[model samples]
Target: MTPTLSEVTVGDELPALTVPVTRADLVRYAGASGDFNPIHWNERFATEVGLPDVIAHGMLTMALAGRIVTEWAGDPGAVARYSVRFTRPVVVPDDGVGTEITVTGKVAAINEDGTVKVTITAKAADQAVLGGAQAHVRLP
Candidate 1:
């Protein structure tokens, strides 16, 4: 059964999601989104631009977070609102340590319409990468 608003509390935590960031993944994302920013695909350009390495697109990371919320809600349309801030860059290394995304949510406020505003914190490799990830979800 899906979780109802009343069943969740202020400190409830969402399940974590781990995604391996690879050069190929970044390339595919760039192609799919039509965002061919050199810093995301070209190592030399990324370095010239003062980045540690080719970084994953911010939207790619946001999509991963959306996946976590969708999986928990069991319905993508159930998410009334979703947003996040990219606090850090996700670097794809040649050796591929692989990044893991963990998200936890707290019930911030419940609306009169039976929707709950959830404040989410998403982390990668134990580092907080996305903060203030908020989502308004319909109660089951």
Candidate 2:
């Protein structure tokens, strides 16, 4: 359901979302995105390049983070703008457990124009991976 503008407050927090990223997910993303960077899949290459392990694509992480706002708005088209800075790589290991990314959002502001600003924080292993992330959305 779309959250009515009147039902939201500056400090209101959206539901938290946790997503697991596996090696298979990374491979699929690479194929679909045509981002054949070895660092995203080749563990040896990644380690040699100074990465902890295979890393997820930045866009993939951003999309997962944006999903919270789109879902809360009940319409993907409701998003007006979104921006984020990649603060760290989401290192994905070969283990079956992989890594989990957690996303949380808080209502930052309600605009006079029927829009809202949402501040987003995305973390992995209790460490922030996205910084200065925010989303602008239209509410019902």
Candidate 3:
């Protein structure tokens, strides 16, 4: 159910989400997004480019992180604005398990217009991967 304005409060934390990203996902994203950057699927090229291994697409990570707010609001259209800074690359190894992305969010404020601001943090391997992540969302 969508959260009401009265049910939300500043400093409230949303449930955490962990997603396992695999090499197949990168290939699919590459095909769908036309972002066939070698670094995302080629470990050799990634390491040559100064990256530890194949890294996930920044937009994919952003979308995964945004799931927290969307699921909380129970409506994708309720989101007004979302922003994030790519601070660190999420390194994905060739292992079958690949890597995991963890997302967490906290309510920063309840606006006068029945909107709420949420601060988000995305991490991989216990290291932060996104900075200044926040979302503005409308609630019922």
Candidate 4:
């Protein structure tokens, strides 16, 4: 069930989510998103371009973070507005266990229209990956 307007508070926090990013995951995302940027799949090319390693797509990271909001809202369509800035590249290594991105959200404000503003924080390797992440969600 979705959270009701009365059950939400300004500082209420959503459960944190951690998503793993691997080279294979990036490859699949590249195929689906048509974003075959060399930096996302080609390590040599990425290194030449000054990237520490092959990195996950910015949109992929954003989608993972957005999942938290959608899940908490209990309906994907409940997200009325969402935005974020790609602050850092999520370095995905080619190993058994790749790096993980963590997403956490807090209810920032409750709007008059029954929509709540959710402030999001996404991090990878203990550093912020997305900046100014926010989502507006309508409650049941």
* lDDT tens digits by residue: candidate 2, 1-140: 57888899999999988999999999999999999899988999999989888899999999988998988899999999999999999989899989999999999999888899999999998999999999999887
lDDT of each: 0.79, 0.93, 0.94, 0.94
Cα error, residue 45 of model 3, in Å, equals 0.7
Name model 2 segments beyond 4 Å from true.
none
lDDT, residue 132, model 1: 76
* Candidate 2 overall lDDT versus native: 0.93
lDDT of 1 by residue, 1-140 (tens): 56877687766666766667788888898989999999988899999989988888999988877776677778889999899988988776656664556666667787888887877776766787787788889978
Question: What TM-score does prediction 2 earn?
Answer: 0.97
Clashing pairs in model 4?
none
Model 1 TM-score, 2 decimals: 0.87
Candidate 3 local accuracy as lDDT?
A: 0.94
TM-score of each: 0.87, 0.97, 0.97, 0.97
lDDT of 4 by residue, 25-65 (tens): 99899999999999998989999999998999999999999
User: What are the runs in model 3 whose C-alpha is more than 4 Å off?
Assistant: none
